[model samples]
Target: MDKLRDFLKSWPGRILLILCLSPLALLGIESYFHSGVDPNQIAQVGDASVSLNEYQSAVNNRRSEILENLEDASLLNEDVLHEQVLRGLVDRALLEQQAKKLGMTVSDDTINRLLREEAIFKDENGNFSNDLFATFLRQRGMTKDQLFAEFRNQLSLDQLNASIVGTAIYPMKAINQLIDLQLESRKVWLHRFNWQDYQQQVTVNDADVKAYYEANKKSLKSPAMVDLAYIELTPEMIKVNEVTQQEIDAQYQSFKQELGLSDDRQISQILLTGSDAKARADAIKARLDKGESFAALAKAESDDPSGESGGAIGQFNPAVFGGDAAAVEQALSGLKVNQASKPVKTQFGYQIFMVTSEGSSQVPSLASVRDEMVKRTKAYKQQTLFADKVTAINDLAADGFGIEDIASQENVPLKRIKNYQQDNNTSALSQPAVIKQAFDEFVIQDQSVTTAIDTGKSTVWVQPSRYRPAKTLSLTEATVKITQVLKQQKASALALKAAKDMAAKIKTEADINKQGISFQALGDTNRQSPLLSDKERSLAFSQPAPKNGVAAMASQTEMGATLIVGDAIKTQQQSQLSAIEKAQTAAIIRDNLGQDQLQDYLEYLRVIHKVEVNDANMASAQGR
Candidate 1:
């Protein structure tokens, strides 16, 4: 118990815990209505389960991101997104389980140094700020122990991934050949057959337009759409209640009390567990009294993983150690630096602690964390209000009331959307979750409000109004479009024939000039050149070296067609590559190979772990 508190309070304990709280990658979201370890699991992979809140959170996250960039959120089908997000979570669970089975761990020294280096926990003077760290965790509803677990698990997962990727074959001979291809360049020339030059000469009559429209009528159908009515609850729509000065003062006092900020102690321990723990602890105390080194004794005698690190448990506090903390604190109260405590009974076993170090009182004045206190106070109030509102809305929903009636009762605005298509991702209320629910067969047939659907910042209730099936347009409506399409096709065909004829006549660059054909002198370029299209780059560099002067080949392009003439095929020696270039090229190859290897390993793990997806839960998603 003492050892874990010591570990948790140390800078390294929750390294990834804070980072996993990526604005993108959620780590225990404060979605009280959804994010708790609820029974609403979407998928079960072995013993690990992914909750519905997790899936909702992922959807909301993705939807909001698309909305932020002014892109259509409806572009992705919510059902598909649901599958993708759930699959990812399940895969993560599998990797973590596998890593645990293999007994993988992040070394204490490595994690600790990383945490201490984290800028979020650092003070103005660059020292680890326990106050700031605690505040951050409090906001996120996380305890230090949770942070430790998160960091350990995340690191272990990364380690497993890296180890598998490391197993990728080098295949240096093939790699060198690929590298040679990448470094190869070519001097080329293009012979053009412009579509515009042929379009003016080709005439299309009314009969042609009618025939083309008749054949392509199915492709010109109008979009299918649905009408919707909904009431949404976004964070901005909810107001935060005020926190009083008295509340701030009370919170300040509580922080100091809970953290034991008066005097912070750092300790190391030698633990003796099992039946004869007390007796063994006494024996070690006697050896310590004889002037043997505490660290050396702990390393040789302790029954804990920390034993490898000379039993250095790091910063100690009561919040982490819990009930056993009372005895440990009392034992440490009388001990000075380098002084050892007598055998103390803890949850783990009997531990003899030595005060390795101590820090000055961490007690902060109300003025010193004032801004953070106000922020924390308001956030707490806001969450309470949000949860209350959600509950109230939920109750209103269950009483057989529609979205309009509920909105009126709750004083939230009701909204109606017209022509809501599955692909209409750009509308104000076009959240993928909402769109998905609006289009659901159950909701469409039932014509009743669905349960609460959580978006990134909002909770939604949707009811379908009407459905509009797709219809084919009349020939008159499709004539203009059909004519344009038919014209481009004929023009392109003519251009390709012209280009092929040009290529057949001109075997060399000099012959191209002799034929009075216009072309672009595309200078030396490699496989990855920005000046050439992907196809153009491959065509330019891949042609056989000219038997006489240059080689010409014809191919179709977007605009028309092109006769490609390769003048010279150039190669750069691998020895001439700069150190950075070589490193970059090697990184590309390794990254590609590593990803494939990692994916193969993950597939193997999936089979071994036996993943079972709850399709009903993933599909229904009837929110709490």
Candidate 2:
């Protein structure tokens, strides 16, 4: 008894014992002590005993799967583990209950067949590999029977879920309609109103300013603030000296060799113009065949902007031409001297080529490139060193060292900022992590304790010198600001009303026609209309057109007139639904309206099952 008491005092020992005993209590004391226990004895449909061993196994399996898929071992967190396990247990229970309700059953034959064909259990010849199957089970620390049982149970539960959710499908007409909507394009003329144009005319009175200030006093209240000291390490400041001329020459020679420019081309061009251009081009090709000067012909006949300067196209890599330059490359592939290419027709027009000379593509030695590398390497090393230094400083602060001591030791200047908030308003702090750490340290019971935190680019040590509680605004201070907001809202309402009145004045299509404006019918403009601005698009679809009058508004730019659809368009769309869509749409409407019915059904199941959770076990699992 004394030993048991001592064990219970220890956190880990207490947690393990509690978890192990809870399942036994739920399954009954006798069954808990027995060997070769029946898994079903832990739970029935309604109230089930969730075994600690089973839950742990499930968590391990899930964790392993996540690690494999993410290829990252460091992603594991206790909170995530707890949440996933709890969710899995709850979902498993729900599925089991659903399976029982549907009378779904799994037999040994079904389990065997599924296992044999599961791909994981199959050999190269497509035959069931019993050894592979056994190995996989062994890896998971499960016996063959245990694995089979779990597989069978899961299959039954899956069938039950499928029956409830049903298959998702879209009819041909719906698919076609979706496709058309995606592909359809819209043409629109847009006019914009500049706010700057109206800003000059808007005047602020003394009363207006006072009212605005009063109403917005709460918004202007100072937020919770923090002050922090940080150190930043960056690579760009690192300096490298003493690069030799020999090194520079070596690098230049290496770069030159790598360029391999000796075999590159410098060619001239000419473009034949006008409607009979093809015929003129053929004639030019014939002259080129007769060995006329290619450069002279390009200068005389080519309409290219580069026709001057003897049509010099300059040097180029032959590999970049792809198949279009295949003949030119082949002809000049082994040419060591200057060569001209036969006329070739390209999509742009006809082209000629020339190979200037041959060159090597060798690169310089590492010794040659070492000077530039040293500068870059120095910067990289400096940045890394700076990060490590900052981390050490943060560690010192976290261990309760003062920021002043750190700054003095590191020989870095430390500045104290006042009236700063740790929240989103702390934009002036420069180092966000420093501010955050300061706020976190300040909130603790120990007022003198300092902490170090990462400020993204640097590490900071924060010491909270003082703490301030939040303050609410006085009513007198808030009044002026409120009045300004109210006034602006009133102005907006009036503007909207004026726009609507203008829209009403244009009653018919005749009004638009009489105004000399052409009406372009937009047939079933769905979500993809490019002509509509975001706000206009949303309003157009949602509000539609009114029946009696035009819904006109000044364009967003305040430069032109605009109209929203009136009642006739809305009526037409409603009447245009096909029979099948109409039926499906009605069913959707019914389902949305009858969501309460589904909730009631789930509630009825809960009552019949009498579900219970072992709160002690859950708490133990959560390390609470």
Candidate 3:
């Protein structure tokens, strides 16, 4: 069980965890909209009924993970995979029931701890926030209570599984054996018998070639290939009307509203200060009311620092004015362009204000924004059209319409792709998701249209139009290959005989120097030696300890044969096992043994409580 848990904690396990927790569980993106399966009962374990929706969700999740990692997408079409996924769900249901029978429970405190410890639910200060946790649950279509309930149930099941497999105590003898195997090294004297020497002298004739071709023709064939008819819809394929005058006007209004602009004024003010500032301000306003220029009045008689530059202040809204400015705001709002106001008291001081510039916020005209509006309108319409078409196509497919029928009704062109194979592909349908759907059991065997598959950039529907089975190669076409094969076979036979003769001579003489064979001495080589083939190295280890440094025996490799004379098997002393190494080895042993124990317990539970599945309902569930 520890081994299984460790595996689940790895990259693949994390992916599975995400799937189980994610809303709709690996029905992929398109499934987010129409992921529901029928809720009818499909299987039973003891008193528990596994619903069609639940089984389908499990299968979809597991299948998605397998297809993502597996190099060949075609394997997704296998019925055995469907069976395995269903069985896994059934087993899980059985285990849950067993856990309940044993009265396993997870406390509320434990649940709270789990939620608090989850880093995703934390704020910048690393404290758990109820708002963030609630938001997370809401996004995944779950209420806080529902998520906690499920999490509690999961914890109970985990405890149950863990309890069945106690800490494993691996036998000392087995541990020693594994340790020795890992550390052992060998010193060897090796001999080589090269097959290339015999290859140059071997001869093949036309009859031999013909016989070889006749015997092996069936094995030389191409894999099964398929041709496809598919309808693909992308944003680029959407055609909509050009931007009209009305559309541009509406968009401009929307843009203006989004910007939230307001009318603003640019002001110039001469602030007066000191004990008699109010009186001074009133006198300044009187002078401004006269024919005196405001800038000249500000430059000569103003008491504030801004008086030097005619008291100019940049354009701003009333809200942008700072401090106890209620009176200033009211005064500024009433003034017109190029108009002066009476003295107004402010946080800084009493001031006389003039409005130099005023403007109302307005949207840009059509001509100035024509090109950008056209682009945005086009993109918006295309997206709307693409989404509508995708929905329509999916609806039609669900209603028993073929892709061709949908294409015709929706005014989309149906394109055909030829010679599609698992590895050799040339179409956009070559995408793994497309390939998986095209070869799905229902798509090929039952002749059904696939569910609308969104490929991020495009949505696609596939129908298999033609299927070709693999066929044997003709003898006439295989002659050249057969000739080479025959020569290799004859050469290998001759080489084997030579090797045997050489081995016999070496054993009798107890020496490797004879029969034109050259030997190299490898000192203290381990199993991972790059100089030798895996088979050769393993064979060297199997040889008995050398008798007075003589070659033990000879063995065969793929392309050649060899003999090894071993000096001794060198291994680490038992006391040399480091503390960390011992702990790691013990953990591995425990995990291995624990896994076996868990499997046995699960099997025992299955027999004690009879489990049943309905095949007919399973098939019907898949059809949905």
Q: TM-scores for all candidates?
A: 0.52, 0.47, 0.52
Pairs of colliding residues, candidate 1: 74-425
lDDT of 3 at 144: 67
Residue by residue across 510-583, what tens digits does model 2's lDDT show? 45445333444454454457666666664444443345544333433132224444323322233355768656
Model 1's lDDT to the true fold? 0.73
* Prediction 3 TM-score vs. true: 0.52
Candidate 3 lDDT for residue 545: 61
Clash pairs, candidate 3, are 1-594, 1-595
Residue 232 CA displacement from its true place in model 1, Å: 17
Model 1 agreement with the true structure over 1-624: per-residue lDDT tens digits: 453355455544443433433223322221222233457787777777777777677667655655677444434555565555566666667776788899999766766677676666778797998998898789878877676666666678667877876666666566667777887877777766778789986777899998887777778876667778888776566676678875665565567777877546678989999999999999999999999999999899999888889999887766666777656765776577899999999888899999887668745546668898887777766776777888888887777788888889889888888888877457777676677777777677777787787665577787787787678988888778788888888898899898888777876666868878677777786788886677777777656766667877777778888778887777788545665766676777777788888778778988888777677786677331
Error of model 2, residue 143, in angstroms:
5.2
Instruction: Report per-prediction Cα RMSD to one decimal.
Output: 18.9, 21.7, 12.8
Q: Which stretches of candidate 2 lie over 4 Å from their true place?
A: 1-108, 134-157, 167-387, 411-444, 447-466, 469-471, 508-526, 529-535, 542-624
The ten-residue window of minimal lDDT in model 2 covers 25-34
Each prediction's Cα lDDT score? Answer: 0.73, 0.51, 0.68
